[model samples]
Target: MNLRANERLSERIMPRPHRRFIFSTLLLCTWLFIAGCAVDQKAEVDLYRRVLDGRVAATQPYVEGESLTLVRAMTLANQHNEQLGLRGEDYLQSLIAKNRAVANFLPTVSFQPSFTIEQRARDGAPSGSTGSNTTASGGSYQDSGKISYRTEAPIVGSMNLFRGGGDIANLQSADANIERQRLLLLDAQSTILLNVAQVYLQVLRSERAVEVLRNSVSLQEARLKDVKDQFANQLATKLAVAQTQAQVNGTRATLLQAQSDVRNGRHTLALLVGVDTINGKLSEQSVTDAVSDPKHTLTDYEQMALDRREDFAAARAAVVSARAQVDAAFAQYYPSVSLNVAGFLYREFYADASKWNAVLLANVPIFSAGVIEADVRSAWSRLRQAMLNESFVRRQVLNDVRTAFENLDAADRKTAEFEQQVQAAKEALDQARAAFANQLAINLDVLVAQDQVLNSELQLTGVRFDRAVFLLDLTRAIGVLPEVTMQAATRPATLPGLP
Candidate 1:
């Protein structure tokens, strides 16, 4: 009895037609909400998974106990540098933009489904008639209530018929942007390689300086001992023993500084190569051997730089993209035509129907408060800016090529001069030591000779390293650094002077 009473009460509150319409609408809304939540949850899960994977990868150990050669260093820098990775991501984004440009030529389709329930009331009673005579006369009579339900499902599609070649222009612009990004990536690679070479050479130079200072310290210690023994025999004065001891102390200090430099240089090199520590011994002789004489004239190198430099190329591509933007802006002047097709389904208390329609639309802009004109002007201005940038970059490239060539030439000359000085200093030191042992020269003369030898050796080491570094700079200025292959475990490529 209670169930029957409840059923009657529910029917009175909501008639059958109204209840059905409400139920259907609620069901559709619930399903759509659930589907949207599922999609969002799935995206969240995938994002978390990627984050976890990145954390694991970051924790993985890098290669250890491997020789860090110049080529290997460059390879690792290219693979692991954050800046290069960002450049790659930019390139990928440009590709996505290109895809979007292509999609503009395809038809767009969308669906809109709706359900509505409405309660309406109407009065049928004349304006001047009495209550019972209102229906008899040509006047409004009684009031009646009506409930209506409406349902519609329309699938609409539209395709562009004509847009004054704007779509084509946009696609071309996207292509130009992609090319620009590629050139930028190449530029970054060259820069990173040059940096690696510089730090690697520095490490070698510091290590060599330490070795030379160590030898000098050992020689000074022997000389100090000799002077002390002569003093015991009263053949050498106390002043001579003290002078020798001072020379030994100075040599030891210089050695300590050189050792410090080696440590700092190695740390910097390891950072550049994206490793925990740099593990290989850098060969000073190998670095000197790798210095090659410049084969081309400055003019030739300048030409090469202009041709191969990625910055110049990217600038040119930017101009092309800007020009495309101008063309796209001009397309707004012409009429745009598109074809649209739509279908609908409706159900109600008084009507049930289905309908389909197709439309051809052409929109021609007659006035726009100068909006289109301003866009064209803005695009043209950017194109002009790009052109000016291209000119500036060309001049800069030429200047860089000439400057690097001159520096390399100067380095070569200095290296040769230092080599001669080193030989002369060695001869002077040998003669001075012999004379001092024979008591024909003072201990001060031996110390002076030793100082000359050390200075000459330090100068020679500096010039040799400078020569190698200048050569690298020359190659980088010419935009022709040797390419290193990126791989899981990269092998060193053939450097300019390496077999």
Candidate 2:
């Protein structure tokens, strides 16, 4: 009976300890699950921030169709162009150069005046005439005291009669340089505008692509479920499910890459317009409107490029400047004449000493060891080089026109071809699904048809975007731009739509 009582006590103790152990185990698992969920949330936030960093925010809110325009982009580019506007230093330099040129035509005037008091010895040499001499007395001194005052004032003037034409050539060169700088500023503005447009288009395209891929992933997931169901029923092979899964994963990877590109494109556009945005999604753009207005044909582009391209004009200007330099270099070998004159006013202790003095002098270039000859040769060579470069650039511009025209044509054709493909694939997909419903087609065939449709849709979207990009490139290459109307640059295209 004592043994039986001990056994009962052991059983009671065992049940309490076992229950406590099970409760502790359950608590630990709950804590681990909560900790894992927190880590996943933190990771998602980081990804969001990274994506936000790449995108440009709209400066102001507007609908996609009306927010930004090409004319507006040009305006913003010009307004924000760092080099176009005149600065204090630029004005100062221009004035200095102008003054130097004007000085060649005007007389320089300056004043020289002075006053003094002096004592002269009786012997007629102005001096203190101090000397110690022995006298009849032990210590006697003799000193001379005579005071006089005198002053003289002079005004000087000078003008260059000739510097063989160096001064004139220099003035002409300065004017040419100023004009060149102006053209350069315009060219820079054009370049910036083009960059803004391209980046903006890229962002828009990327965003749209992301959206399409998201939809594609959903479709892929749904198809995956159907394939798994078929496999479970032994009507579809395992290999079919695996193929669908692979396509889904591949598409997901593509989606990720598209998102990354969209982010980077947005960042570039943001910096161009000087926006300071972070941690916010970029707004979508309607690139269709911006790119829809292209009107120039290949021939038109060639003609316009030859006439309107800023680089071509700048090249011609450079050639002219180089020729001017040659002339200036040759002119250095000739003589130059300058005149100098001076006048003095009265300023003296004595009235007779106060009078005006004037003088005139001429200067000329004498000689330098073959320096002028070398300069002329160098200038002539540069002129030749400039001319050659101008020709080369013209040819390059022509080539670009041809290439852009070809690309534009190809893009147009591809858009049409892909659209047709998408239509055909859609019909095929429908037929496959109907056949499967009637038991005449397998699930695998339907899945294949769906993939083909998705691929065709993706290709068509890509082709559309390519056509738009080509349009932009052609516009830029032809040096044609619509007037910019906005106060800021635009964001890039959003992602493309997927199947």
Candidate 3:
């Protein structure tokens, strides 16, 4: 009885040991799961931190006292503009294509390793496995089964010896594509520069207009004050005071409009220069002095544009690229040749060996449903279109040069005439003011003279602004703008009141 009791106690103890092992295993698994979660959470936090840092960097403010000029604006636009970035990506792709085309002439190498298992059946006499003749001698026979395994590792290489010049033509086409992208980038730069110039000039013009109108308003205010004093002394009528106040109000309204224009221009310039704000003052005198007569003749400008224009160069590159495409298409008419080499190691249930092999292959083009011929025709059509486009661009360049030249000449003559008008109007206003003070002229005549003087000054400002714009346009048409240094100037703390 004691032996049986001890045996039952040992069994119970063994079962308790198994339970403890199970509990420990579950606890360990739970700890591992928690640890994995903690690791993943840590990684997520790091990623979020990096993203937040990038956001902070992108939102950083521009530096103070950063002067914006034509060249600086162009550089900034090129660096930040999405369109330029896209073109740069395209250029990179073209370079990759060129490299790929060159690689076609180099050999390609690869490796393949594989394992195979097979089962086969054989006819034999029981365990002895005698031949069929033994079975015919009245011996018992049965079918036997066997399993086998095989492994093979191979290194293979191939190279194209000839592709009827298609590879060469493709390489040439890639080169042309690269050239086209470069010229396109240059064209984009020129266009951005011109746009920046336009906005810059507009800002200067609006600011100057504001200044002129402020002066006019001040003069009108003074005149109104004088009229009010005369009326108090019974020397001038209340009607004169009312008219002078009306003139002041009108000038103030115009000044407000000009100030609005200045703000809008600055906003546009900020966007172009990739800055949050534009802070520096534009040099009006420097800009006016930069607008001079073109030193070259119209014919010379036309020739220069033809030679230096990016669009013209891009058109030529397109023509060459199209011709290469034509060649690539024609290459399909001929046969291709290639060479292959392979080294292999093979193993089976009964045998293991290694071997090397070389092969030369030739592929001759057979009858296809006019696919190759169709491609040739399409390529030729594109080539023709490219040539025609080049011609059209040439004609367009000529027209632009001549038109810009004519407009610039007209602007020069108009500017000279307006200068003379401004001088005469100032003299006439002086005489009118003197006569009014002496009581030889009426208040109406003096007011008309003041209006004429203001009008003449405003008209002169417009003419000068137009002349500066025309000069820029003419230089752009000639495919070369005179470089102007960005002069450093202090920003004014305050502008004059608009109302």
The alpha-carbon deviation from the true structure for residue 327 of candidate 3, after best TM-score superposition, in angstroms, is: 1.0
Rank the models by lDDT, top first: 1, 3, 2
Reference-based TM-score of each model: 0.78, 0.70, 0.75
93-131: candidate 1 lDDT, tens digit per residue: 787799899988999876665554433323433433322
lDDT tens readout by residue for model 3, 1-499: 9998986654333334434544565576688679866635455334323322221122234465665554455445544555655565566567668889999999998665444333322433343332221233332222222332234456789999999999999999989987887676656655665677788888888888898999999888989989999999999988898888888899999999999999999889888767778777665543336344536777677777887777888999999999999999999999999999988743222132337679999999998799999999999999999999999988987888788888878888988998898899889889989999899997877888888888888888887777777776766676654232121111211111112
- Native-referenced Cα lDDT, model 2: 0.62
| Superposed model 3: Cα runs more than 4 Å off | 1-62, 115-150, 285-294, 345-354, 482-499
How large an RMSD does model 3 have? 12.9
Ranking by TM-score: 1, 3, 2
- The top-ranked prediction according to lDDT is 1
Candidate 1 minimal-lDDT segment of 10 residues: 132-141
Per-model tally of clashing residue pairs: 6, 37, 0
Q: Go through the candidates in order and give the C-alpha RMSD of each one to the true structure.
A: 7.6, 28.8, 12.9
After the best TM-score superposition of candidate 3, give how far the Cα of residue 142 lies from its true spot, in angstroms.
25
Clashing pairs in 1: 124-140, 124-141, 125-140, 125-141, 126-139, 126-140
